[model samples]
Target: MIRRMTDTALSEENASLKARLAETEAALEEAVEAQRRLESIVGELQREKFAARSEKLDPEQFNLPLEDVELAQGVLEAAQERARRALKGDGATGPRAPARNRGHLPKHLPRIERVIAPESTLCPCGCGEMTRIGEDTSERLDIVPAQFRVLVTRRPRYACRRCSGAVVQAYAPEHVVPGGLPTEALIAQVIVSKFGDHLPFYRQAEIYARQGLALDRATLGSWVGRACFHLRPIVAQMRENLKAADRVFMDETRAPVLSPGRKRTKTGYFWSVVADDRGHGGTGPPVVMVHYAPGRGAAHALRFLEGYRGRFVQCDGYSAYDKLTAVERPEGAWQLVHCWTHVRRRFVKRLETDGSPIAEQILHRIADLYAVEKAVRGQPPATRLAARREHAAPIIAALRPWLEAQLSRIPRSSKLAEDIRYTLGLWPGLIRFLEDGQLELDTNPVENQIRRIALTRKNALFAGHEVGAENWAMLASLIATCKMSDVNPVDYIAQTLRSLLDGHPKSRIEALMPWQFRDPSSLAA
Candidate 1:
């Protein structure tokens, strides 16, 4: 009986020990998970605050909105030639094309025999006759700002015979507003001036005042506001089309707003979404859009991508994207591809701070990768990916040991050391780009687009209110995408505004997209 009781006690002790071991393991796992979340948050903050400042690009690298002074000489020359033709009573046929010459000089430059007076003239060198040795004459290119012309439409009145009622006129074309002062051309000017030129409405008003046109800022704002409202359906279609794309690239920058209750109204965000509609054989339109939100959060993304069941989204390592790691519909739908440039940027900053030779070498290798990218400029994503894998993958693989070695030697407190550590942390995501050709090495394309807004932001500081900022976003979306697709901003804005005013139905708004309407031949000019 004593022996049996001893065995029971031993079994009970073993069970207690087993339960304690399980509890300890669970606690350890929880601690590890918490540490990971904290580290992730810290890394995200580092990426947002510190990463991009390392590689500063020249402002000229981006084509910021053209100031009047920056128009190309040839373009201005063309415009001037047209104006001269118009002033000379030549219509749009353009002075009859100056008839092509059969390999002969024009009469203007024909060689002329010199008139000589034997007794009156002598060469300065005391020769028998003087000769012209390149006269000091100059040819100057000149331009004039576009001058406005008015067209008046007259309708005749007729009286009905043997009737008291009189017929005054025929019905007017449906789209044009009766007695409206603004013409399609004038409306186009306003659109391009505000969006392409980034001149605020008030500034544009001041400009018009200089020209003796007393247009109110409020009226100009009303025109812009109405123009954007007219195009909102198209803009909405663009958003939907962008999300429908299998791949999208996104980024955001600050947009300020003015709220009456708030002490500072200049804190808001504008989100940009860019997608290559051509990627999935989407011949409809290549879409790019900007959405203004009160704050920057995953909800903004979720709203933009609400109906999109795309395969992947490529963005920098922003925590907002972490929320979409899995979803029910579009099974295998959302894969997050991080940006290598972001990772490299962290190390680049560190290298600059620490003056590390190894970091420099790694950067040189990255430069080589960029060189390859430059060489394959017009190649499709798949071909580019293949080329990158063949040339860049080996270098990236070779980098692992170098990175590990540097991390070991560097002190943790050093900024360069933290950069290296952060970079290594993102190794799996960064290197994943090498494996998929569709993915970009960096989010620079989207970031490149954002730089324009950043500059306008720098100049203007912030928008007036949330609605005003939203208008800025809508207009920027259309104007920027038009610029990207090689459509003339002036022509497109004018045409779109005219169409919408002329009773063009909003149901087929996608047809108005710049990419859709872009004639390839027009792009060459």
Candidate 2:
């Protein structure tokens, strides 16, 4: 009997230990899974930090893979919550960090204040009265939804007492669109909303419908077309002013237009030309013009630049610009200056893809050149030319031979070889900045303007027709120029349309340009 009791106790102990072992194994698996998730989060954070922004530069570079990071963070929080519950025996709450305050809102924004007062002015202790003291105030930003209102115009008519046949009355104001119901302010708002804010007409129509205004997309389209028609003369004047500059920056971006009777959209182009003398301190206002074309061809560029009297045109390494080299005009022959940014981008891509030390070295040298340019920016052209010759020329001289030697070592089919050849081929144009202070190192100004078009294209998808694309270009040019001038685009468009309808002379229309615009108050004074 003693042997039987001892064996039974040993078996019960063995079974209890096995249960504990299985529980421990499950805990271990949970901990290991948590550790794996944390490790993945760290790896992704590292990649996100080090990756190139442009996919063309490094196709492998990820653009902020936040979904995985968020998932890992959630898992970590859940595990911590479980651990807290186990330790505290339930009803335990996790502590949260207090939210940090963002900076105060701008004082320039108009504020609407509401006062909250006590139910009784008497003190809580039953004092007879409480004297007013300084009150604490807090501000919260609020917005008022846009509302549409009808503008009624009534011109009273009178007749002479003796001669009833002869009648006289006040002349009615001219409308931008004859018989159109929308006012100039409303038209300006529509244009600004579409091109400046990238809101499509269909979406804008839906928003209006929600506000109890039944505006059709076709009506909005018609309004935009008419506005562009009225604004075309202004754009034409802008182009004339842009072409008259000594140097100009030109670039192009694709704009797809929907073809009638087809489901597919045809690719169009917006050729942008920008003139800014601020870089070299010339005495001319900065302006930009975008010309729409059904195709991206050399002929479009040639036609747009037909009457341009500019000495130098800065552009990328596109062969379409090569056609401009053949033009022999009496005013002046166009000098095509290649962008250093384009050349540097080639090496930048190679560095991102292959980790080439040679590419990095080239980039360093180019950066040094840019540093010199920065120091000379806003100085006279003569000063800029002198600075480049002194600081930038020697670097270029050294870089050319190094690049050629590196090129010979690389395989003919390699990207590095292509980049080296491109730089060498455009070497003359790249160095032209040394000759004239008026020339920019790159066509970045025009490229910057093109980005706004890209945003609009991304939102609208494609223009409804070729004419619609032309209308888009016209309005965008004015809006972009207004932005550049720091003028309120809506106010400028509204006032200018009213002035144009008021029979403002075409000869004096330059006064209405964004750079030259004056407030109605100032104009009246």
Candidate 3:
């Protein structure tokens, strides 16, 4: 009996040991899962933090007309849908819409309807008589026909009575040549076609040849080069005045060129500097300028900012800005405001490819900041500053502690963790906007300018040469600035060309700015 009782006790102990062993293994698994989740949360927080710091305010700072934004949004949605379909393997996504061929006459053109009227007059009590008026007449009053005209100038010479040798013809309005076929207006049209329309001179030559004009591309190029030369002073004035502003945005993109010493594959960089003077209730001038260089370096930007004395310059976190000192700056600029959107993009990139819980939290926080911005949008800068202080300050202040606490918990290998650490390092510069009313939350305006150039480059592929690239910078600068000011680019370019040809001085060029030229009364209404 004693032996059997001892065996039973041993069996019970073995069963208990098995149960405890299983429980311990399950607990260890749970601990590992908890660590994984914790790592994810930290990652998400860092992502949000980085994105929040990189956020830019320039693009959304201005109120775009709803019609324009809506139109762009429609295109975007359609493109997105197309992308979805393409992802499903249907076909190419967002290919350019086929050009509508309107040159052909309608297959069944409508004809004018013929009217019939009774020729007999009404019958009277005693007799019926037939009376005819003039034959029924039908005429089309609004008859618009395709009309063309050519101006023929006949310069008649008059001989002096006393001195027959002295003869004179009407001076050609200081614009036309006695024998030249191209007028100032015609030259302006060609200028618009070449620079404004991006039609290379060689291509334009073919287009003209098709119309029986027989103009050489080289000659056409020379004419355009001369036109730009004539307008150089105006461009200079625009640049000088624009850089003089207290705040500016800068962006750069590749501008391929065919350098004489280099192979055809060599390329250059086109740097775009954009500024909006309408920020202070339309009291400021809108300036968009471009500078071309063979490289992407601080020296090119340094030249552009040569005489600029401004308080704030909003730009992406290009390392070049770090090299500038108060003495080096023409304006003795104090600070470089980095963009949060850039920082956010880095974290967003990681999130899309790797699911990091920490990145998600940071995104949430950024969304919160945007929500606050949405509420205060279009308010006066002072009001916006105030709203940010009241609403956004606390959120930012609360984020610091979380960032610090989470940074300690994340592993070094995680990409999200490194992003968080980098953003935290730049905390002072990123959050500097809370102290100043003039600063923007992001560098989106400059980014918008960059995006435009990017799109153009994507379409055209590359610039023909360095000089051609420079012209691209100049023309794009003016065109984009005009667009920002809500002025039709074609109208501004045409008017400026006319005014310049009419002996308009360079100093008064500000009169051509979009916002200034736009009827102020329309703004009032």
Candidate 4:
């Protein structure tokens, strides 16, 4: 009996030892994993601080262990809080800080004051006639949800008593879309929501459905098409105005158009031309016009700028723009003004990628030139010209030789070498800014306008057809121009369409342009 009892006890002890061993092994595995994760987080943090900032950099460099970092941080904070609680020994909640007040609503907003009075005039103790007292006041902001309403029109005909055959009735006001259910204001809202707000038609249709309105995407698209048809003349005038400027900035961004009979999108381009002399102190108002083209070929650019009388055309080093000076036209060929920002960007990339000291030196020199430009910004052309001559010319003269010397040292295939060669090739155009004060240091202004196109592209993904792309360009041009001029796009589109339907003459269309537009209320005041 004693031998059997000893065997059973030994077996039980062995099983318990095995269970404890398994628990310890599992814990060891977890600790190893935690250590690996912490090391990964540390490495990523180091790379992020010291490595190149470009998104094009190695993907592995940015694959940070974010979740592990968060978990570790939480564990540490909890441990620290527990230690503090143990030290305190009294576990009562601490007093909280008062909440910060948000500022009051704008004074310009219309206020609808509502007064709340006591239930009875007499005091609570039943005293005779409660004395007049000051009242407490508080303001809360409120909004009335957008509601669509149908405008009912009534016209009655009257016949003369003596001559019943002759009848007369008041004529109905013309609609932007004759016999269409949408009002001018509603159409304007659709256009603004689509272009300015980047809300796609299908999404807009869904939103309307939520409001108990069963408007289809196709119907909204049709409205956009018709609106573009009517607004084409104004866009054409804007183009004329833009090209008439002595100097204009130009850029192009890709626009995808859906291919018919195929389940794919074809690449297109939106060629943006911007006129803003405010940078160099010229008196012209800023205006931007975008043209949609099936391709990014030089032919499209040439055709777009065919009647342009501008002497100086500023753009990047795209091969297409080479034809700007190569092609012949009624007006003299354009003088190409290359962007210094492009040149600076090349060196910046080289410095970031290759860690080249030479590229860093070049960037600093370019920065000096920009510093001079910054001081002269918004000054008259003559003043800017003088400032460049005084400060910028010396840097350019010094940079040319240094660039040439570095070209000989670096490998011909290297990015740094390629950048140097490009800058040398466009040396004359890059220096032209020093000669003309009206010219900007870069084509950044037009590029800024192109960003809006990118946002719309991201939301809509692609245009349905070529015509849809054209309509996109037209509406974006008007809306962007309105924003540049600080004119409210909603008000501008609604009022402009109303005036057009009211038979406003084409001769007076220039006045309808965003910069030239005037509010009737302002005139009355």
RMSD of 1: 16.9
Question: Each candidate: what lDDT?
Answer: 0.72, 0.85, 0.69, 0.85
TM-score of each: 0.70, 0.77, 0.66, 0.76
Across 96-181, the per-residue lDDT of candidate 4 in tens digits comes to 33433324666655778888776889867877888776864566778998888888889998899997598999988888678888
Task: For candidate 2, write residues 343-432 as lDDT tens digits.
Answer: 987787678666789899999999999999999999998999999999999998898999899998989997688989999999889999
**Candidate 3 lDDT tens digits, 1-525:** 999999999999999999999999999999999998788778668765553333345665456556688899999999997788878777444565444543343433444667776555666664777566576343332455523236677779899899769988886544323255565556555665554455656676777776667789767665656557656766777787776677777777787776566656476787777776444343566778888899887877777777777767777777776655444544455477777777777767666657677787887887788787777666667877898899889989998889888888988776777888878877877887787666666777777676666656655677778778787787777666666767655555555666676777656766655556553222210
Clashes found in each candidate (C-alpha, N, C closer than 3 A): 0, 0, 25, 0
Clashing pairs in 2: none
Q: Which residue pairs clash in candidate 4?
A: none
Question: Which candidate model has the greater TM-score, 1 or 4?
Answer: 4
Q: CA shift at 312, candidate 2, in angstroms?
A: 0.6
> Candidate 3 — what's its lDDT?
0.69
**How many Å off is the CA of 434 in candidate 2?**
1.9
Off by over 4 Å in 3: 1-151, 154-168, 173-220, 277-282, 326-331, 506-525
Quickly count the clashes in candidate 3: 25
